[model samples]
Target: MTETPGASGAPSVRLTAGDAEVTILPAAGCRIASLRVGGLELLRQGDHYGCFPMVPWCGRTAQGRFRNGGVTHQLPINAAPHAIHGTGRDVAWDRLPSLEENEAVFSYELAEPWPYPGRVVQSFELTPDSLRLTMGVETADDSFPAQAGWHPWFRRNLGGEDVAVDFSPVWQEERGADHLPTGDRIEPRPGPWDDCFGMPDGVDVALTWPEQLRLRVTSPTPWVVVYDEQPEAVCVEPQSGPPNGLNTCPRLVTKIDPLEITASFTWERLG
Candidate 1:
């Protein structure tokens, strides 16, 4: 366990077991800043390193507008015409009291543009062979809507070996001009996909770096977005809902039933 000094004075925690090490930033959106196996790094460090959690709502909200209980709420357009990801990643997270070396927990309260008074909690647990992540949202007042997930920008190559994605999705959600899902489910399409897919049984994606490392990402959610447009990095996002799920298929979060989701990324050394 360790902490790094930053501008915001945010503390970074590092967990090491055997030849594996993982670093996380609790203040900076509670993101995993780095993950290394043996001596090789698997996740990309672009602008922000490793992966970050998406809470309150995952992905984007079309035009940043959504209707709830006969009222239309408009969110900030962080990504031009839409609100990509959620406000959680752009704000600081409060660290929760914990004494474990391999485990850390952080929480963020709902704020403006979200229109809901709630709280999101994210927890990370790391071991020698795998990393488990869990996210949840709850409100004391009325029921609202929410979603959660992780956006991991994986390195395209590991030890000079190119990475290849392998997954069997039932259908792909057709994309529109603005990159939003068009509500049409088509057959499994080709690679270089920046679209969402429907995995009825759940989301299970295998990213293989040839003979170096092969990581499997699994989640209970039925939606996953695969973006491999760039040659430097590929993103396999395990989201609770699609890009425009708020407007397409909103999942109500009641006082008794808060939205919760969990996902894991486990890897093995390839021969």
Candidate 2:
């Protein structure tokens, strides 16, 4: 692991494992600066992982209005017409006291002035074994239910046409039009995949490379959304709740009347 100074005086943290080297920007929302395995960039730069937000981002209702506990509370859509990843990703975080050279922790308070009144802290630690990312979200108000997760873009060799993912459990099929759940479970088959899988009791899932590398993600989140945009890239997102879980399935939402939610993901390279 190596520490360097990033642009605008941000702390640049770097970690190397097998054939991957990952860099994280602690000040710019702790976003991933770079992810390269075997000298190949997996996270698309100038496209994704920019100075946007910290990981374990949050998603509220488009209008910040949802029915909870038989009451409807309105929330302002920070991003007009759509509720985007919560404030943690966009806000500057406070660097915490550290003891490990390969690890970095950042904390931020999402107050009532914001659309959502919550406190979120994210930590990114790189070691000789793998890269560990963790996030914790807590709310001062007890009535708001929030959802959060990671949206990482994994590097894939699309030209080989042999890239495939081995999911841990059956996934709920989504309506082609709205991309929401259809309440039906189906097995993995051929063709394009843009669906979320309800993770079933597993610490790790394998993503096999055609000829070069195999990546495994060990996460505490119970679901993983796999998106395969042909000729673009593959995104295997580890999420705490299902997509549109708040709007569609009310039970999946995390209730925080003084609420707290935590999730993590660990990535390791295997040859």
Candidate 3:
């Protein structure tokens, strides 16, 4: 995992308020390269390892295919059998003006491999206790299905205790052997999970590093995918929809209205 500097020769953007600090890489998928609270880094180190915006779509679009208005469109399969994440994460975004130093915005226009003309905007804002992430997508012409979310790879250990994940999901999306949901809802199972969970009341998950810190990840989105199989990090992702949502639960982004979603991570020192 490498942490990339901003576009060209530009340095990454850093925002500080109180004891919290945030580093963002606009050229590297507009991911949060580093997040520190109470003088301890919460996110896993590296460029591709930090939290990144998953826009237009989240997770995988099964077999890289979807239908809009009765027309079938195929996406470039970057994750073998499916298109993982989205095109937004693989391109450099253009920075937009912000009235405050603690907040920055970046935008990218959809291009080839996407089969649409649209714009995606991602914003990162930091306060003393939390970091807020907002994402939106609006099509330039035709209406299209879309989704937005965040994938944050937080460190399992905070140099003290390994982080513990806690959350109550309404149900789990039964995963098929191919790794896509089987369209069946079942009881939430025990980890190590690489599955998506339902939280119709909204997503609220906690990560605790005993005697170190506690972070609460919250979002109004009803879907979340938790991946804890990795030895070094734990991911708590909040999404606007489920994986393969393009085919099963499409959220339309049109010229009149755009699809938008937001998530936040708030933390407190613990003993």
lDDT top scorer: 3
Against the reference, the lDDT scores of all candidates come to: 0.86, 0.59, 0.89
lDDT by residue for model 1 (85-178), tens: 8877777788787677887788988878678888898888888899999999998687877778899989998766789899999999999999
Q: Report the C-alpha lDDT of model 3 over 1-271, residue by residue, as the tens digit.
A: 1233554454688888898988888778888888988678888987578888887789999999999988999998988899889888788898888887788888999888889999998888889888898999989999999999999999999888789999999999999988899999999999999999999999999999998888999999999999999899999999999999999999899888899999999998886
Query: Which residues of candidate 3, in runs, are more than 4 Å off?
Result: 1-10
For candidate 2, what is the total of clashing residue pairs?
8
* Model 2 Cα lDDT, one tens digit per residue, 219-259: 76666667677555566666666655556555322343332
**Every model's TM-score:** 0.95, 0.76, 0.96
Regions more than 4 Å wrong, model 1: 6-9
Write out the backbone clash pairs for model 2. 19-38, 53-89, 54-89, 64-75, 142-256, 142-257, 142-258, 256-259
- Tell how far residue 61 is off in model 1, in angstroms: 0.8
On the 0 to 100 scale, the lDDT of residue 108 in model 1 is 88
lDDT of 2 at 270: 42
Give the true-structure RMSD of model 1. 1.5
